[model samples]
Target: MRIPVKHPWTLPKRLLGTFVILASIGRIQSEQKSSKQPNIVVIVADDLGWNDVSFHGADQIPTPNIDALAYNGVILNRHYVLPTCTPSRTAFFTGRYPIRTGMQGKPLSVGEPRGIPLNVRLLPEHLRNLGYRTRLVGKWHVGYYTNEHTPTRRGFESFYGHYSGYISYFNYTISKNNHTGFDLHQDTASTLEMRRNSNYATDVFTEEAVKVIENHDATEPLYLHLAHPAPHSSEAKEVVEVRNMSEVNSRFGYIENINRRKFAGMMMALDQSVGRIVKALGDANMLDNSIIVFMADNGAQTEGFLENYGSNYPLRGLKFTHYDGGVRGVACIYSPLIKNNSRVSEQLLHVTDWLPTFYSLAGGDVNDLGDIDGLDQWSAISLAENSARESLLINIDDAVNLRGVVSGKFKLIEGAADLYGNYYGDTGNNNSYPEYNITEILESDAGLAITSIGNSLLTETKILNLRSASIVRCNNFTDFANCSDTCLFNLQNDPCETTDVSADYPEIFISLSKMIEIFESELVPQTNTDVDPASYPEKFNGFWMPWVASDSSTIIATSSLIGLINILLHIFSLIFFS
Candidate 1:
């Protein structure tokens, strides 16, 4: 009987194993139970430069509220986007390249009616399908040329903003459209004329945004897209104030001093809008659960009066160029999931990344959204991984096709052309002469010499000799062969694009050129609805008759008669001299 009584060590060991199993089961259950879905809000600014924000080292502007987000969240040092509005917006919405979405050219004008194609599914639509409420407030430039691409048809349950790209801050009338009227909408119904002389659009947009947030149901997760069209082109009121300065004397000069002041003011207004949105979320007790993102659509346009006020500084080129100044921008993301508040310098993310990133945050299967070019950058931002995107492609204007490829520290840009040349005829055949190699010119002290050559050619052949030569003849230059290979520069040392380094790095030139061809082949040419004007109600087939005013004499005579009547009436009333 004593021999049969075994020691109790085995019993204790069995008890320890049971306890360890229970602890493991408890840990697994806790992790599964604690998983949560987060809300998302994306605030985008149009044509804002890298130095525009205070957090990114701007002393002229104060963006305390925006800086707070950067301070709290991960500040992305090398984020890239398209050089124009439509392309950027399309990329963000569809999670595909702009060229893939068939938005590769200049923005669809007010006259041209085209929208997001039916085949493509937007981010909001996918989020909505997953039981999230999506709302879009601000400028929707993806489609206005047609009804099919409207926000309602895309995926958003609610839309509040203008269809055309730009509107008068005071009157809400688009200047190019001759003050033709349009109304802002909420869902299917038009809510207001979107025109106000006393109230600024920036302020009004913020107010409407707050209202939208307040109206959203707390139980349902919300995705709010706040797109601000401020700090793009300076408003007339702000322009007048800065144009009087001696440094900005020319109203028509490139990058005028007044433009900067006005742009600063507009940026301030946008910052205030951000403050309002954040405050609204806090007021609703939704801050902790919401993922907030703030970024710019593209680079600043320094042409005309803008250059006198805003400077891309170390970055070469402007909004229309493919240089770092045009594509590189400030991007920040704030979320509870981000463990530390540090700058993320590794990942080279793009606008398309948002779709998959948001889907993962919302606790949905990202693969369910189907094919997309953007990768999920969450792991990179969370410090779980260290990697960057290999290449990012962007198209600025219709005439400029640019491909930027970054490998480690070496960045190469190919097929750089000037869209301004199409307007001025300096480059001759916007298609033929590639004008300048940005990397080459910015690397050397002879940067000015290169620019001077192009400037002199532009002045002599295009601007000064405009009346003598036809548009075709003015832009037809056969001298591209002489300088085509001479314009390349090393961007790492010369970010300002001042020198030509093609002589030393011949391999880079060939690699970048090949990359450019590959990129171009993938692009599906966007149907230019602006060409061959067509009236509404007609289904656009990429072809329309050229716009020609019928009965020109009646229109001219009526205008002349009205002018003559006003003069005669003034003369009779003795008001002309007064």
Candidate 2:
């Protein structure tokens, strides 16, 4: 076929059009190339509470460094997570709801064979495929049974932490199954349990985190999970004692109550850890190009079996309960990509949202994470816009004991029993105190003075160096002693979730309760136990048992059995040869 002849002037016009199209394409390419490859460092505080941070109206305990990070970042005022450690972590790492992975309910004992399902891909695994280095520097509570469930086997390039929930900070031991043994591990295998260590768990984890930052490969991006288990004391101890006793006492004498004093010391040490990590990143000249995300794994654990003595004051409930106090937590994100460095984002977000958020921020498509429950909230977080997530399944227990749902400002929760089918949740710590808006205080002279105690910059310049969240100021919610049936509360008005308005909002209750039934339908049967040992050699579990207090008997029995086996084998061999 022959082309039709064009006018002589058409050639020039066509060339100009071609050049413009190419120029536009070149511009698009340039923008894509210039997109920042931020070094991501996610810092998680175990069982941290809303009122624990000094920036959030807690005057007795100071969290200067954490406040500084919150000031220089987007404060997420409506963040929520699971009611327990492993479920929260599983959600965060997998971008899927913990119930989907059968990780819902309580945390695993150190000796439990259960772990985060091996089939589900983790956030680090996704990042590792994208030319990033991944590391874990604290608790790995999801699972640690056979070698398959260890952190090294999961996707972490390097893991310098314990395999259990919370171990003795100094002794690095966990008490379980009527037995206590070493719990700390350097990589995957347990390190020599010397009974005592010169280093505390918090300090050791901080040191490892600093080293990860300092030794990061500049050419490649990084994704570090600095999961510090602080303000989380050992349930093994009746009276909680703060680590680094002399140092804590020297720095914090203002706190009068010894329990409060000990708790404050733990918080301060964690705060110091944040400062040290930030300093290390700054020293490495990666601060400006870094995306720092700080959050609590769950809400305050409170003075339950753990005696954490944490304050989720102004918020009702505590860890292991399907209530606001147990789910809502402290969270913030800081990066140059964010439009405003100091704004409180009221956008609703979930702990599960982080996997998608971080992957998207690192230039990965979240759509590839098939059938995930987390939504990509990058723009909502970085630009302070409305989050894509409007509703969430806070807790959908497979056991059908406790369940919760959030749609807009309305949240409905009911606790007939805990995950174990025991009647739980009769909230008593009613915080009738008025709201102390620290953000407003920062904008005033009085706030400048209050903020000066922890931040030296505020003292020198009479300016609040920290950023304040933009939440409404009002009185705290009223008291509700019990949550009968489905308790309903408008989170915006009664954020502490102290009132049970289920009687008035029957229609709203019906609507949200319907959602719970639908979600519950999709849940798998709860497996509160572990895989059987018949699948693996008995010798594989020759290590610590959660119930065993010591390894001496186990070692003696194991050796005696091994010798007997050897003698039997020799005799059998002689008989067969004869």
Per TM-score, the best of the predicted structures is 2
Candidate 2 per-residue lDDT, tens place, 438-471, comes to 4433443222322333232233222143333433
lDDT of each: 0.58, 0.69
Residue-level lDDT of model 1, residues 1-578, one tens digit each, is 00011232444687656645554554343334223556788999877776676555434555656655654566776688876777888889888887776786776665565656655668887676445778988888776433435677566878877766665566554433232444354554543343333477787778878898898777678889988767666344543232124433332223324445555567667776877787787667666677789998877776653331344534655676666667777688866567654344436788888888887776556776667877777888876466546666555233544555554445565556554211210111123323222232222222222232221122222221221211112112222212222255454455445555666778876776676667677777776665323432132221111123334344334434443343233233222222
Model 1 residue 306 CA deviation (Å) reads 8.7
- Per-candidate count of clashing residue pairs (backbone under 3 Å): 32, 11
- TM-score quality measure for candidate 2: 0.78
Give the range where candidate 1 is weakest over 10 consecutive residues by summed lDDT. Answer: 420-429
